[model samples]
Target chain A: MKIYEFAQAPNCRRVRMFLAEKGIKMEYVHVDIGKGENLAEDYRRRDPNAKVPVLELDDGSHIAESVAIQRYFEEMHPEPPLFGRDAKEKALVEMWTRRGDFNMMFNVGMCFQHTTGFFSDRMRVFPEFGEESGKKAVQFFSVLDQHLEENRYLVGDYFSVADIGMLCSLDFGKAVKLRPDPAQYPNLVRWREELNARPSASA
Target chain B: MKIYEFAQAPNCRRVRMFLAEKGIKMEYVHVDIGKGENLAEDYRRRDPNAKVPVLELDDGSHIAESVAIQRYFEEMHPEPPLFGRDAKEKALVEMWTRRGDFNMMFNVGMCFQHTTGFFSDRMRVFPEFGEESGKKAVQFFSVLDQHLEENRYLVGDYFSVADIGMLCSLDFGKAVKLRPDPAQYPNLVRWREELNARPSASA
Candidate 1:
């Protein structure tokens, strides 16, 4: 099995962090998304969506999307249980995972793509919407801050894929000039500090 | 268990359809989103995100987000599995699920929210982005149409939540004057017709 990924991409980092957490090692194939290599016909055949961090199984079947790739491994390695141990915990983890993807990652990505026109060669850029999305991302930090005030992690007390999702997204927020203001979101900043200290964060 | 939702919301409908498919009946508690009832403190306490289709378990804990709620039951039921029966199929299903979400549902939703200013009371709306998102939605239909020409379902011959997510989003596309043009996307239209024939579609 191999992972086709651009290491700098936030979604790629998410998959890497997940694998690191599970202590699962695999072959890595670099897809240089920055150079528009992902748009090439060969890469598109690997993943029609042309996204990085696609997991190619031994049978040559490919799985795209960060959560899906992570879940594939989670199912294979059910040791540390990053997804969750039971139904309720799994539901909560999934909820937070989706929340982080939609509220944090999407906004940060939009802010980067639209504001910087990073993908202008492929897609249209809308700076106005990008500006609004950046603000929306900051608003989510307030919500995260309040939630983190009572809990050490996004769901319950243990580290999970939900935290990993938020960690990568928030870290990637730097490209868009987005960061939780320590004064305004002290709890969120505290949570970030804790997650960043983890070994998997470097993945 | 009970569900707190606005009947007409696409996400609420998605959950209702999933339950109907699973043959699970639960009490429905309406939260009138059209009148901003979801923004009320009580509803916010029920779900800090203030979105619909929240499942309230017998123990009084809440599960927000359609996928998470559906997954909670999926674990409990595990019949004719909508998520997938194995690791590989599960990964593919999840990949398609996230694809339908990011490519179709999100674009349709952005078109509705930004173009119509339906949620102007709650958030900023950018019509330019909405227009572009509508075009992106059509582009995704082209991709779906081509895929459907080869397979009956998004992942395989069997129906899964990926199709459900697309079905609800495409149906909701009508609100934003978006639909797969039968002449242009014949395969997609055919696939839609098949899913629409399902009894659970009306849910």
Candidate 2:
């Protein structure tokens, strides 16, 4: 399998962490988002959307979307399961994972797209919207902090994919100045440190 | 089962369609997103994140997120399957479904949240970035138009969850002046009609 990636991208980081957790050593093809390498013809064929972290399997099948890639990994390697074993556990993991994604990951994405204008040439042409996107992203962090106060992980006791996905966005959030306060989000700070201590989290 | 929902929300519409397709009669509890009902104590208990389309199962397991709810329904019902059967087929379904989601559905979400500010009181605040979010949505539609031109459905050959997800966004897209142009997307128009004509299209 091959993974089209970038080190700094949270979405790409999610895939890296998942691979590291499962100890899966697949080929990695770096897509330089900063240099617009992903915008070139060759990269476009693998992913029309032109995002990082496209996992291309040996059979020539490509799986884009960080969540979908995470799900694929979950199925292919069920031990130390990221999605959990039973239907209820799986649903809970899926539910919280989506919550983390839509709320935090998207907030982080908007902060970057609308504010940073990194993909202004290809994705968003407007720069006026970045400030407000950055604001909403801060609000989203509060919600996560509250959740982390109760659960060891984002969803439950186990460190599921949801935890992996959110940690990337939250840490990235700091780079764009959307960091959660230690006073307010102590639980999240604890959990974040826990994941950070892990070797996969470093990935 | 009980579904907390609002009709116009594509997220809620996703669950409605899934339930309708599975032929499950779920009791409905309207959560007026516009009126800030979702943020109230009662609804937040169902989902601490305070979002719509929370599925409270008979066994008391709560499933949030439209895609997660759809997964639960498919897992329990498993007939007239929405997600494909085999590993390859399942990957295909997930691939397109997620593409449609990020490229279209999530963009539509950006369009709505950033442009309209409908949910402003309950943290829908900020118009500056939201407008940019909406335009980003329009950009995504162009990607969809290109894909729809070649494939019969978002994935291929079947009206799986991806089609349902796209239809919800495309139909919802019109509310924000983001409809696809027949001149630009002839094949998308063809697929749209076929999807609209399906027995479960509206479901």
Best-performing candidate as measured by DockQ: 1
**How good is the docking of model 2, by CAPRI class?**
medium
* Model 1 CA deviation exceeding 4 Å by range: none
Query: What is the C-alpha lDDT profile of model 1 across B163-194, one tens digit per residue?
Result: 99889988999998898889999999999999
Candidate 1 residue pairs in backbone clash: none
What lDDT does candidate 1 reach at residue B117? 88
DockQ, each predicted model:
0.82, 0.52
TM-score of chain A of 2: 0.92
lDDT of 2 by residue, A1-203 (tens): 78888988998889889889999887888778888998898888888877788989888868887877877876777668987566767777778777677777776776777677777777644444556556766777677778777788876787888788888888888767887778877877888889999999876
User: In each prediction, how many residue pairs overlap at the backbone (N, C-alpha, C within less than 3 A)?
Assistant: 0, 5
Q: Write the residue-wise lDDT of candidate 1 on A1-203 in tens digits.
A: 99999999999999998999899988999988889998999888888889988999898878999999998888888889998888899899989999998899999988999999889988889898899899889989988999999999999697899999999999999998898889999999999999999898896
The local distance difference test score of each candidate is 0.90, 0.78
Identify the leading candidate in terms of lDDT: 1
Q: Model 1 chain B — which ten-residue stretch has the worst lDDT?
A: B77-86
